[model samples]
Target: MTTDELIAPGTTGPATPTRRGSLRPLLLRLHFYLGVFVGPFIFVAAFSGLLYIFTPQLERAIYAHELTVPVGQAKQPLNDQVQAAQRALPDATMVRVRPGDADEATTQVIFSRSDLAPSHWLTAYVDPYTSQVRGTLETYGSSQAGPVRTWIDELHRGLHLGDFGRLYSELAASWLWVVVLGGLVLWWGRRRPAKGKGRRRLLSWHATTGTWVAIVLLFLSATGLTWSQYAGDTITDLRAALSWQTPTLPAASGHGGHGAHSEHAGPSGPAVAATADQVRNIARRAGLDGPIEIAVPSEPGAAHVVKQIRTEWPTKVDSAAIDATTGQVLATLRFDDYPLGAKLARWGIDAHMGVLFGLPNQIVLAAVCVAVLALIVWGYRMWWHRRPTKGGFGVGRPFPRGAWRSVPTPVLIGLIAVTAVLAWYLPVLGVSLIGFLLVDSAVGWAKGGPAVPARR
Candidate 1:
């Protein structure tokens, strides 16, 4: 049976009355408009995210020569590896070093290029056992992501258009939850299925699939928003003001001695402070084990910051600060001591990136991405089938004039308050919402009333 047959005659229009005082119609209008307008950006994000989760496999295959080595009889000292990396890049300054995760893995000796941006660095993969320089590659950002992973990550975040393009992603994330919840309400209030399956099947599939992925979609939207540029900063500042910031070792204040500028010195230069071996000893005393990251001190009296992050479920994130010259442990912070907000932020980011549960996490997130793509495709298909033959493509209908007047006063007030808060919380989303409302109001005024569908 057709959808037209399934929906009652008068109920097909936006002004149709219900117990909820036209709430369903308003939500339907919102759902339809957001889906039609925002669906493309969501599709791009999901597709790029799908590609990003496989980065581990892609990196392993593409960089095997640089990342792997045969298990050798004895491992070389950390400083020896650093010296080897320095010999390879004679002019570059040492940045940090990452211990290999396993016997067959190569240690990373990172170096900063004076000519490049501060965030850009070159990483030399050195065999831990033989101190042999395997290869070197330039990386970007704090995570030091390689060329391929960086490219994919940038595409996912900003389509490689930089900060300005980031708004597209933030916009998609902000509206995602609204569209999902609105979809749920519309599906629940939909008419009963007609006698035989036909056009009704489209609605059925769309609703069913939407319901199936609704919870996961919400989770993704919330977590994705936390990483957005503008919204993320607001969230961080809010959390900090609430005393929810993650605890970390305090920086050393006064310059303890000479060699404070060791980080700026070339690899061939004299040791400015404590050697890598001494810093490693200090980190060991602070209970950091397994693959660790040591950031070289960049200034006098600065501490050598050491961090260990395990990518499995129940992640182990711990860090310590060691006095660069004295090789004394300055401070240590463990994951178990993180505040509630900090823990949530850490776990959410890791899970979103498919690192929280290891391979299983990656597989599940990849499936979600696939489902999102499918949902977007089906949504567009439904819209295309329902679009009017004459007019340019648009959301089919909007609530009738003054339809909002029937909404309960309290509910209306609550919505307005929430909208105001959201706008304040995420300025970009707020601006976009205001723009949408302005355009919607202008069109309604120009047309003499809110636009309503021509009933089939």
Candidate 2:
């Protein structure tokens, strides 16, 4: 068939067929089907991720009262701040303390109660200088995000559906790269721009915007998949087996030799080990800086662990362990010692969150998000405009029978093998892919066998 003949009426086209005529049609079929069936989930994921990247600003404004205080003369001791926080939540057991980095910031004393799960804890913010409790709020997991950020994060991750909802995000993330790459192929295969107005204009816009944001979209997809519930575990295991886990400081050989001792001192025990203030001093003396977190020892002979994670580009992640009783530094790990894979993982996650390069990173992420939203909107417009009034939800006409035979045998086998491996790596994507294929087959059978082109 000639290129002119392939162009649909009223649509612009340099619909030139490439050398791999058979392969091009197959790719077009896949792209059209995925777009029609899977696009909504992608839209949701993109929208949620866009909102998540602005968490810093959202949190600052929402938590202003508890997170900030007036600059004052010499701050009170860390012990005093802890005491104030204790007074506010006497039933809670102290877990960690974070003395704010600036004079205007509030010190955070984190606590856990018997009723709360490990991931759910309470944080009491206290003014360091006055040792007065500013406020108390609930936070979750290792990220330690406040209530508002926690809600938004959960929404982004699982739509508040818990584990089941998580599948949606993961599935969306897994298929995103495929959808993007297929779109790129289709756009590239079309040698000439579609001419005319209406659907043609919409297609042109969709193709142009998609090409512009393809690279960014790919980055977003990769980083996003790293956090997916199922696929994420696969990635973690793969990285660990490859020796790519984040590095940590090693404990000094004799530091905890006194044998595990209880963190709390009894009336007869060695005078109440070192105070919280002493532990903080030990961390500082050990070379730790920039918004460090001091985890109080929970058991006897346990060392106080202090960690600092600064997400700015050239990211800094370091940790130290101190003997709780003697206030002596026991071990330390610096970001510079991390392996290449570990470093890349850190950088990728930080960049994904829009914090790696500070303001510029946020700007770039925001622009990509906006562009994605526009592309999705334009895509739907194109689909809507081109729908067949008489057909059952026009998802593009199918290719002719015997089209599969046109693809070379080796190429077909290779594609199947790749798909199988991907399915193994990402179960949700694999299952969804199979489900779509089955549904398409059933529909074709119902329509009296696979649709054959009247004239191709």
TM-scores, one per candidate = 0.87, 0.88
lDDT of 1 by residue, 1-456 (tens): 223332333333433343444466566557767877888999999999999998978888899999899999999988888888888988887767888879899988877766765467788999999999999998776566788998899899999998898999999999999888988877776666423343356667777888898998899999999889889998889898988887766653332211222323444433322378888777777888776777776564577777885756767778887876777787778888889998888888888888888899899888889888888887777655554555555533433444456567777789889989999988877998899889888987898875533322
| Per-residue C-alpha lDDT of model 2 across residues 1-456, encoded as one tens digit per residue | 322235454343323433442566667567666776678888888788788888888888999999999899889988888888877887767767888888899999877666665477788999998999989999876667888878878888899998999998898889889989988887777768776677677777787888988998899888988999889999999999999998655673322211111132111222112377887787777777788877765456767777785778666568888877776777888888888989989999889878899889988888888887787787767656544556356543433333455466788788899999999999889999999878877877887885343322
lDDT of 2: 0.75
Model 2 lDDT-worst window of ten = 264-273
Error of 2 at 65 (Å): 0.7
In model 1, state the lDDT of residue 372. Answer: 83
